[model samples]
Target: MAIAKGYAATDASKPLTPFTFERREPNADDVVIDIKFAGICHSDIHTVRNEWKNAVYPIVPGHEIAGIVSAVGSAVTRFKAGDRVGVGCFVDSCVGCAARDLDREQYMPGLVGTYNDFEADGKTRTQGGYSDSIVVKEGYVMSIPDNLPLDASAPLLCAGITLYSPLRHWNAGPGKKVAIVGMGGLGHMGVKLGAAMGADITVLSQSLSKKEDGLKLGAKEYYATSDEETFKKLAGTFDLIICTVSAEIDWNAYLGLLKVDGAFVVVGIPENAIPVHAFSLVPGRKSISGSMIGSIKETQEMLDFCGKHNIVSEIETINIQQVNEAYERVLKSDVRYRFVIDIASLAA
Candidate 1:
């Protein structure tokens, strides 16, 4: 066993504190990673705080991980001791399942989250990457492109892939008019990526606060949803709308912005039940859908795609000690975009 140190949520309400734990020694299919940067995902907050109604005590919560490979087991062939790598939302899925075979393992019944989940053994808990080191299965590890810096690229493991998967699946390339709701972490990536894919990207934010940043990030149009006229002007305009905020807004209003046969995809998790009327979709033949983080193959593709486009999340780097404060900042929407932890602080 290898001793590991990280911040842990001991209870639902208490702050995270330094915790020591054991990481299993590398097996033949395992790769030991020196986790350098861990991105603070909103999902991490949800899990740690028991907002998701499934909290395990002493949980070390983080999934958007970027690091360097320090060692590899004998059976691992794709990674070496010095490779730059990442681990995303999930770590494992049932082998030989149809979803796994199709490289859509995110939908597999046995999908194991990188954090706050049980291993395939069902007894051993799986810890996450708000730490100095991690041991991951070779199949679950990703090769981050050399051109992308590890710190900035960390959030791509989760946030980037989360947006990329839906964009790709919905064919948000040339000739598509796409609207991204919310100008925060997930929504900003949607604009950047949808634009890169040749879509006519627009930003539908709560207010104009992030208008400048949205345009700079490739959003051709930016409108404040707070203005009634904004929704009126854009009604029946978009071919696809991706909502990335957890705020309970008028779902029907967003649906009305889509063209006939258009789709509204939700990647964000709202706290309460979203009330959607059947008329929201029946009139326009619109469809509502949801996407989790991408499969391993898809996530690798997202990393390579970001590499080619020189795209990375807009990040504010924080040390391990500031994670609790970071969480509060996140709740207030105080971050410019994503928050990445410099894991070296854990060692200090």
Candidate 2:
């Protein structure tokens, strides 16, 4: 085992602090990584603060990871020392399950999260990228394109793939009118990817504060949702609407904006239950659906696509010590986009 340094949430009410833990030695199929950067995801804040109600104490909360390969086990065939790589939400799942066979391992019955969860062994706890190092299975690791910087690309593991999956699933392309609800971390990526895919992108945000940023990021149109006239004007306009905000909103009002047979996809988790009327769906054959992160195959596809288009998150970098402050900023929507932690600061 190798001793690792990181930050952990020892309890729900307290802030994260420096922590030391052990990483298992490389196995025949494992890859050892020296973590270079970790992106601060809103989900990380939720898990650390126990907002999700399933957090385990002393949890190291991070899944958007970017790093370099330091060592590879004898059986690791695809990666070698000094390779740029990344790891996402899950580290393992049932090896021979149907979901794995279908390349949807994220939904497998025995899926293991990268942190705040137990590994497949049932006894070993799985820590995450908030640390200085990690040992992961070669099958679960992804290669980062050389053109993409490790820091800006870190959030691609989670935020990038999360939006990419739904867009691809819905066949977003030329002639499609897409509305992205929110202009924060996930919303910004959706705008970039959706526009790159040839879709006519629109941003429906709480206010017009980020309208300029949204348009600069590829949105063709930006509207303030807080304005009643905006809703009235755009009613039954979009072919697809992807809601990326976690805050409570009127689901039915958004549903009314969809065209006949259009779909409303949710990628964010709101605290309270969303009440949707049957009339919202019954009228035009419009549908409401939800998407989680994508499979490893799809994630790699997203990375390759990003490489081709020179796409990455709009990020603000911070050192590990300032993570707590960053979390507060994230809650208040103070970040221009995403927050990425420079793990090298841990050694200071």
Candidate 3:
């Protein structure tokens, strides 16, 4: 076992504190990463606060991990020392399944999370990347392209893939009229990627305060939900509407924005069940769906695509000591987009 240093929440009500724990020794197919940066995801906040029903103590919550390979297990063939790589939400799953795409692994009954989840062994709990180093199996680790810097590329492991999976599945590309609801981390990526795919992009934010950033990110038009007329004007105007915020949205109202056969897809999680009137979809035969983060194969594809397009989440780098304050800022939607922890500060 190797001692790893990181910050952890001992309980839901208290602040996270520095903690040291032992990680399982590497196996033949494992790769030990010298973690350089870890992105703060809203899901990490939910898990740490025990809002998701299952709260694990001493949880080291981070999955958007980027770093360099420090050591490789004896049988490791995919990577060598000094190679850049990343680990997303999941670290492992039920070994062999009938699913051929591998991108479907997250749906497997035994999907193991990078943090607050158990490995396939069932005895060892998984710790995430808010630490100085991590040991992940070679197959589960993704390659970080040369063009994308490690820190900025960290959040792509989660936010990038979460938005990309749905866009790809819904075929948001050339000639399509796409609307991204919310201009935060996920929404901005939706605009960038949707535009790169050749779609006509629009931003439907809660307010016009971010209109400039939205347009700069590739949205051709921007509207604020605060304006009742915005909804009335955009009725049946979009082929695809991607909802990225967790706060409850008027299901029937947003559903009204979809054209005939258009899709209203949600990637964010709200605490309460949404109330939708059937009339919202009855008129246009519209459909509503939800998406989870992508599978390992799809995550790699998203990263490669981001590399090709020169895309990365707009990030504000923070040190480990600033994590609690950062969490509060995230709650207020105060970040420009995403927050990345410079892991080097842990060893300072």
What ranges in model 2 sit over 4 Å off?
Answer: 98-100
- Model 2 residue 328 CA deviation (Å) reads 0.3
Q: For each candidate, how many residue pairs have backbone atoms clashing (under 3 Å)?
A: 0, 0, 0
lDDT for every model? 0.93, 0.94, 0.92
Best by lDDT: 2
Model 2 C-alpha lDDT per residue in residues 1-348, reported as the tens digit of each score: 999999999999999999999999889999999999999999999898888899888899889999999999999999999999999999888888834375677877888999999988898889989999999999899999999999999999999999999999998999999999999999999999999999999999999999999999999999999999988999999999999998889899999999999999999988788999999999899999999999988999999999999999999999999999999999999997999999999999
True-vs-predicted CA distance for residue 276, candidate 2, Å: 1.2
The positional error of residue 298 in candidate 1, measured at the CA in angstroms, is 0.3
Clashing residue pairs, candidate 2?
Answer: none
Once fitted onto the true fold, the runs of candidate 1 whose alpha carbons sit more than 4 angstroms away are: 98-100
lDDT for each residue of candidate 1 in 145-221, tens digit (9 for 90 to 100): 99999999999999999999999999999999999999888988998899999999999999999999999999999
Give the per-residue lDDT of model 3 (tens digit) for 1-348: 999999998899888899999988999999999999999999999999999978878899999999999999999999999999999999888777515546688777778899998888888989999998899988789999999999999999999999999899999999999999999978988998899998999999999999999999999999999999998999999999999998977878999989999999989998898887889888899999999998899999999999999999999999999999999999999998999999999987
Tell me how candidate 3 scores on lDDT. 0.92
TM-score of 1: 0.98
Candidate 2 vs. true structure, TM-score = 0.98
